[model samples]
Target: MKTFTKLAFLGIFAATGIIIAGATAAQDAPAKLGDLEVTGAFTKAMLPGQPVGGGYFTIKNNGKSDDMLVSVSSPVAGTVEMHEMAMQGEVMKMRKLDTGIAIPAGKTVELTPGGLHLMFLKVKEPFKQGGKVPVTLSFEKAGKVDITLPVEAAGPGGHEHK
Candidate 1:
């Protein structure tokens, strides 16, 4: 009877630990605002003395009307602007999007490398891996959504980077 009681207590403790861990993970999951869902947001680690950085994310619009990402702002940078990289003839060029990017209804728009991304101009400090950068995204219809872009190593991949 004593051995059985000890085993039961240990099992209960293990189960509780698992439940707590799951709850914590769920709290850190991606956020959904109105009909828009933002996920997989991250930024790459910056090089030494680099004044610029890029941010990428995936935004899903589930509403009936289309929405536009108007602007992005962060306190870590002096200026944040929406930029697009394109190949013009033999040279690659980067240009700012004055009108912002449009997100059609029921579609997911990805802001990635070598494409549409946020430019962090005059970064106050270097973005380190395994850190979170607070950014506010302004949408035409969704208004404003605050999200934390996880900082990862300079690479092309999703989060969970080591």
Candidate 2:
């Protein structure tokens, strides 16, 4: 009787763990906002003493009306600005989008590296791998939605950290 009870308890514990893991995965899935699907939201890990960080994500508009991403803010940085990088006359120039990025109806907008991205200025602490950065995205029509961006491992930039 004791052996049977112990086995039953272990099985229940394992099933509970699996259920909790499934729930956590669902929570990390794409976040939605008024017919908009926000996916692949992540930021690269930053080295210690690094003053800035970059964030990338993809937004899909499923509605018939267009929307605008007005602003992005995070507690990790003093200000987060939307920026664009383009090649102009053999020089890669970067500019801030004061008006914000537009999400056309029935279209997808990707904020990727070397193109459109979020610039985290005045960062209080460097982003570490396996950590999450909480941010609030404000849209003109969809209102505001809070999302968390997972920090991934940074690629080699010719620098080594102890």
**Reference-based lDDT, each prediction:** 0.71, 0.73
Quote the RMSD, in angstroms, for model 1: 17.3
Candidate 2 Cα errors over 4 Å, as ranges: 1-27, 156-162
Q: Record all residue pairs in model 1 with backbone atoms less than 3 Å apart, i.e. clashing.
A: none
Per-residue lDDT of candidate 1, residues 61-128 (tens digit)? 99899999998899999989998765554445567898999999999987766567888888889888
Tens-digit lDDT string for candidate 2 (25-75): 112678899989998777777766566788877899999999999999999
Residue 4 of model 1: what lDDT? 27
What would the TM-scores of all predictions be? 0.76, 0.78
TM-score attained by model 2:
0.78
* Most lDDT-accurate candidate: 2
